[model samples]
Target: MQTEKVIEHIVGWLKDYATNAGVNGFVIGISGGIDSAVTSTLCAKTGLDLLCIEMPIHQAASHVTRAQEHISFLKSNFSNVTDIRVDLTPVFEEFKTEVSLDGNQATVDMALANTRARLRMTTLYYYAGLKGLLVAGTGNKVEDFGVGFYTKYGDGGVDLSPIADLMKSEVYELGQFLNVPNSIMKAAPSDGLFGDSRSDEDQIGASYPELEWAMKVIEEGKTISDFEGRKREVLKIYNRYNNSNKHKMDPIPICEIPSDLK
Candidate 1:
């Protein structure tokens, strides 16, 4: 994949989109993950106002550190880049107090984890609205399309997705080219929603490379009967996520009224 050309294309695309939309620039949540690091860098390269926000809710120390490191790296390299840290721990706690927690422990925990992402999304959009900036998404191909791993109307809600077409491996290639912090490049990929040390692999039960391969084979018209052993297991994991989270991948359902009735 012409990595340099790809980067140039994304940068040019972003700049053109923002200019056409009449927005000053972009505002994105920095999660210290490869996707965010690469996407934010591409935004900065456009020479437009780029706001990197850190919204942490019981976030792991490593995630926080890596996020800050990446923000610092961006600020040093790009004059148009700026950052802010918003600690939402108290806000999250208050929200839990007002909501019903009656459910299966696992289900309740999952809902709250998604809440963290929604809160961060709200924060990003709040600033974007105030500053006339578009909310830039950091999701990649695997998470956004293949597995539907992100929260709907949360991290999935964005004005633009600069890297949604790039696979996870391709995003990493862009990260390396953009000179993202070494700590971020080396850290295990995580959603950081659980506020623990669990990586995305732990939650998905398949590493990105495995999922990427599964996505590729499935796209090529392969089926479960064609593989065995661990290959089958990975395919199963990918299919489960892709099926269950189809709602996130598809457009919201709208009831169409009959023209005669109208």
Candidate 2:
């Protein structure tokens, strides 16, 4: 899909947006995933101040290693890139102590995982505010629009999304073109919120390619009755997520006051 032209377009767009906004540059959380690696690289290409932050809360070793590897690669290649590692494990533990944990194990665990993402988001914004930088989001098309797989007010919180229009496969293509660290490019896609090795596929129950196909067919006006077997199963999975996470995808509900009432 004119990969080179697409990359140029995104880079130009980012630079223009930041200049128009009067921000120094961007700050992004490096998660060692394909999306972040590609998005951060795009930011670096703009030749603006790029701060790569590593905020880990009970994160897996592999994820941490890949994140560090990618950051190192960026620093070596880009003169404008800088990085910092913020260990939030203690902060997370303290937060857990203050919150209610009365729910069932699964429910409580899910909440805590989302908390991890929110903490990282807060950290990024904190720096953004202090340094006059915009918080750059790393979400892609499938995760951001198709499945709504990210945490609202958490990873979904951002000043701008550079890759939200690109599909997961397209993000990978950008990663390849950007020369992201091999370790990150090869690792399984994950949210890293659960502090485990569970891949996004494990949580979503569908590979990105499968979800991409489903998203395309659905956009083309296809229905569940048109497919069978595994295709049907994948469609069901995609539909369930798309429906349930619509809140994340849509604008926040605002109650409009009647003119008489006002």
Candidate 3:
């Protein structure tokens, strides 16, 4: 579908989902990335009461600035858009001091990074509960499912995901169609969990466009033997990330028995 139609459909779906689910509004954590920018714009288009929150825990200044800018844009275009900033640094620091871990520094750093996401998740849901709103998620297809890059119960925990099916490339396209600020649309995507502000590509080892192509190849049941050169490299990277993160994407395993007794 065209970007215009996709935007309209997503808007309509948001409206219908809220109406059916009896939610009064949506609460979304704005990370200053294209996905969040597009998701917030779509939620605003639904005409429901919405809260665009910037929960910064030692977040990058550039990211916070872009988030506030996008929030301002949303407020100007949509009166129902309510914006707020929550600082979770103190909470994170306290938690960090309280917890103890054994392993390499990398492991500890990763755990702390994920803690930031979970802290924001808690903040979003806290407000959502108070306002009777659903927590809207911003993850796109590539990050959410293709490589399972989101932290489970952190960025992955949401009542509704409006764009989990869109590829990262598609998200950029929709952001442009929505007239999102060029700064955010062109900004490197990141989870904002790392204090040093590494781009998602830096963390993932492959860019979104490359990841998207590799996702297609894998989903089609193609083997690495089917390609050579750059294609093989892409497949290798995809498999490395996707295979290790499978636990993040799959549903919880449950023990079940047949009802043959009946």
Candidate 4:
């Protein structure tokens, strides 16, 4: 598919979703990453009131400068861009101390990362309500349909996702197709959490290409006959998300009641 057509499709998807949701514009988290960068650009080009917010923790200094560059790109392209710098160190510290989770560094880092994600989500919803815009999800197909790499109430919460159906590789191609800044396209892809230690592939143990192939096979209804070995591996990751993120994927929870007189 031509990249320009993909961009147009993204715009149309957002337009349709917004119409259904009764919203006019989009609010995106600018994490100095490729996914958010492209989503912001698409929202801007469609003449939407695109608001980009930056919420970075103390651990993720790798993309701090990149965040500013992304804001610059958004400003030049979109007139309704808002750059908000939210430092979440104190909040994360308080959370750790309150929960007595200040012992484990990994847990602390995870908490901090989640704190940033939730804070950014809050900002998005705040302005989304004010401007009558929906919160645009930057997660692509690799993260969305395949593995569910996003956080539950944090990055996973969104009003709509325009590029959620596109694979990560497709997003890269679309970036070049739309002439997004090389800073964004060439920049490394990370969650900007835990001192740049957490990567999409690192946590999933599979690349986007591999995940896409498995997804296509499942989509075609041609199951384990071909790639049974690979299917097993993908199933492991798939099940991990299913087991760990119950609240994120499921319908409203129902409290289990004991069967007393059955």
Candidate 5:
């Protein structure tokens, strides 16, 4: 589909979903990444009131700067866009300390990182409830489904995901079509959870482009080795994440009654 058509479809979908659900507006947590930037822009285009939130929890200075920049862009460009920056450092620290006392320690950096994602999720929901808005998610197809790169019940918790079917590469295309700020478009993708700055590729063991390629290849039931050399490494990383994160990607399980019992 053309980029313009994709934008039109997403905008229409958001409007229809909000009207059907009788929600007041769209609420989104902007992370200064291309995906969030695109999603927020799409929501803003729907002409409904939009709340663009910037939630920083022990975030890197660069990430915070980018987020603020995006917020500024939104406020300047969109009349219906309202935004605020909420710092969750104190809340996160208290939660971490309290959980540790209960034998649920945050010893591992990854554990603490996920805690940050969940905290942001909670903050988003809190505002969504107040404003009668639906929480718009920023996840794309590759991260949300192919590798399940999002934090389950954390960033994964959302009322709706507008771009969940778009690949990371496809998201970039939309970003360009939407005229997202070059700072965000050129910046490396990061979850902005950990204190130290690390791109998603650094944590995911493969770049978005590499993973996207691997996912497409595997989806076709073709061997990864068909592409020569280090490309094979993409297959290994892709398979590892695809298999391990199935739990995050799959729907919640429920107990099923036996046929006779039913």
Candidate 6:
């Protein structure tokens, strides 16, 4: 498939969907990661209202710097752009105490991480509400389809995704085409919930380039009978998330009454 044609098709899909849904814009969390930067740039090319939320919490100085760079890049390109920087330390701690979870430091940290992610999602949706915007997810094909590298109910909860079909490596290729800054593209992809030590690939135990090929074939409408070792491992990871977060992956169930009208 031609990459340029695919890019144009994806952008066109976003615009046509926005018009059909009666939404005027697309809101994306600009985390300074390649995925978000690429997504924001592509959305901008569509000439839609794009809001980039810079929500940082207990993150390192480098993350904030890169985020600003992304904002500057977006402003230079996109016509309608709003950059909102909301520090989430206070809100995170308050939510932790409110929940009353008495766990160790690791559990506490995970809670804080999930809190920050959900908080950002909430903030984006608020502006989305005001502007009749749809949240454009930043997850790539590898992150979304291969392994579940996103936070449950956080980044995964979005109206639509433009980059969900592209792998991480392919995303960088497209970013190069869009003239995304080399620094931003080469920087480590982080959740920024962790200061610097952890990363999506490191946590998942497989790089995007290593996993994308297998991901594409398995997700296609084809079957294999002899998937014993590596394929088994992939299924294990996929199954873990699929079982763990079934609620997040599915719609709410309607409760049935004892006597209901049919």
lDDT of each model, Cα atoms only? Answer: 0.95, 0.95, 0.91, 0.75, 0.90, 0.79
Total clashes for model 6: 0
Model 5, span 1-262: residue lDDT tens: 5999989999999999999999988999988899999999999999898998888887788878888888888889889999988989999888877765443444477788888999899999999999999999999999998999999999999999999999999999998988898999999999988887789999888999998989898989988668767788888888899999999988888899999997
Clashes of 4: 0
Task: TM-score each candidate.
Answer: 0.99, 0.99, 0.96, 0.82, 0.94, 0.85
Q: How close is candidate 4 to the true structure, as a TM-score?
A: 0.82
Kindly report the root-mean-square deviation of model 5 from the true structure over all alpha carbons.
Answer: 2.0
Q: Which stretches of candidate 1 lie over 4 Å from their true place?
A: none
lDDT of 1 by residue, 160-179 (tens): 99999999999999988888
Q: State the TM-score for model 3.
A: 0.96
- Residue-level lDDT for 166 in candidate 5: 95
Residue range 56-150, candidate 6, lDDT tens digits: 77778877888799889889877788777777777776776788677798787777777788888898898899889999999987677656677
Better of 2 and 3 by lDDT: 2
lDDT of 3: 0.91
Error of 6 at 240 (Å): 4.6
Error of 3 at 228 (Å): 2.0
- Candidate 5 TM-score, true structure as reference: 0.94
- By lDDT, highest first, what's the ranking? 1, 2, 3, 5, 6, 4
Badly placed stretches (over 4 Å) of model 4 are 16-24, 102-112, 221-247, 253-262
Give the least accurate 10-residue stretch of model 1, judged by summed lDDT. 174-183
Question: Best by lDDT, which number?
Answer: 1
Any residue pairs clashing in model 5, and if so which? none
Better of 5 and 6 by lDDT: 5
Task: Please write out the lDDT profile of model 2 over residues 178-243, one tens digit for every residue.
Answer: 888888888889999888889999999999999999999999999999999999999999999999
